[model samples]
Target: MKYIWFLPLSLLMLASCDDHLLGTTESAPCVRQPPLTYENFGLPMIEKNCAGCHSSLHAGIDRSNAPVGVDFDTWDGILLWADRIHVRTYEDLTMPPTGGLTEVELDDFDEWMRCEVFPNAERF
Candidate 1:
């Protein structure tokens, strides 16, 4: 009968293993310390997460139907599509059809958008 306690303990451990179970939502505000820039943070992230389907080099079916002129290979493209990117990524959760980004990546994206993109866009 003492072994019955193991079931609830195991369930608790399993539940705690996933952040979603802890009631954390993707809408959580990002706090940037040193800050995230396009060169250091944004570019690399886009290369990894977005470029596969959103690069200009990918044409016809290779582009994965990412839409014409929706490339993110350049900072200029990113700046031009910033609002659409936000809506598609955060609000709609529809881009990056691969859904490969981790929690840390998402947080970095949030920080880059909030702290860098909107503030210094025109200057860039």
Candidate 2:
């Protein structure tokens, strides 16, 4: 029947109007991205990603440790090696020694290298 064809077409049109099908469900709760200060973002990321081998006590012991004179446990130490860290981690994509950095973490590192410096930030 002619009306039967309309039933299938109407059903198809109704399905397309459904919010779920259109990806229009209720909004996700908003989450503020955490600040990227050293205390908030930098320290935790380095401790999680870089410290296992780059810390003073672990350098000589961990097979993946940074070479001698490189330590990441302290802010001063990180500043000292910041350039090399920038190059190795971002430019060469050859740090962390295990799992790779996520795009989020890499963005944070790029911001830190470009925009951040401590109150007593060292020269050279």
Candidate 3:
């Protein structure tokens, strides 16, 4: 059938593992010796860097124009928006509009997201 070519083309596309289309680096496997978690590494980072604008407690003008339901005050919230967080904070490099995270923090964040948050299921 004429459509037979479509199958191979589709397989080729899938084989490319283009994660950028999803705005996530989920294709990258966790290489960190010890994975980072929300409690120890992520919470402090979010509190210091994101909560001022993205916390649930912050409302109205205090939210600093951050969209509602994007709060990073809780682990669940972080999980829900994990991809967006990765794209904005890490890939796009457009987050924390004023004060940016240090290089060390960015590295840790990249690790946490790739390993703990949006881990590549293929690795398992």
Candidate 4:
């Protein structure tokens, strides 16, 4: 009878001790995501932020129709002025000039510029 009780107590103690032996802790490592690409970053940001004003046939910056005069429609035009756009909209806090995206969205934009856009531009 007493032996049976000792078995359960020993098992519990062993289980608890295993955690200490393995050096288990309550904390976990944090992970962050990488940048976005043209297919993901450009289209979504343009659609949500720029399209309202700079859409096709609007204010001489038609984006939906074709690449024309700093067009945000194509990759070439976007890469052409990524820096200006980033500086003004993100860095300088100018674009969407009114209500704008949140901090995470801005960070995403910056990451995209740093990783995806600049690297490809340098290749060319």
The TM-scores, one per candidate, come to 0.68, 0.63, 0.74, 0.58
Model 4 pairs whose backbones collide: none
Best candidate, lDDT: 3
Measured with C-alpha atoms, the lDDT of residue 25 in candidate 2 is 31
As for candidate 2, its clashing pairs are none
lDDT of each: 0.75, 0.66, 0.78, 0.61
Model 1: residues >4 Å from true position, as ranges? Answer: 1-31, 122-124
Q: Mark the 10 consecutive residues where model 3 has the least summed lDDT.
A: 18-27
The 10 consecutive residues of candidate 2 with the worst lDDT sum are 20-29
**Candidate 3: tens digits of C-alpha lDDT, residues 27-120:** 4456655667877898999999899999999999999899988899987788778777888898778898785788778878887876777653
Candidate 2 residue spans exceeding 4 A from truth: 1-35, 63-65, 117-122
| Candidates, ranked, lDDT | 3, 1, 2, 4
Better of 2 and 4 by lDDT: 2
TM-score of 2: 0.63
Better of 1 and 4 by lDDT: 1
Tens digits of lDDT, candidate 1, 1-124: 9799999999998877833122224455545566688889999989988888999989999988889899999878887787777667755667798686777877678678766675545454
* lDDT by residue for model 4 (23-91), tens: 113222122354367777767887778766654446543344333465555676567766666776666
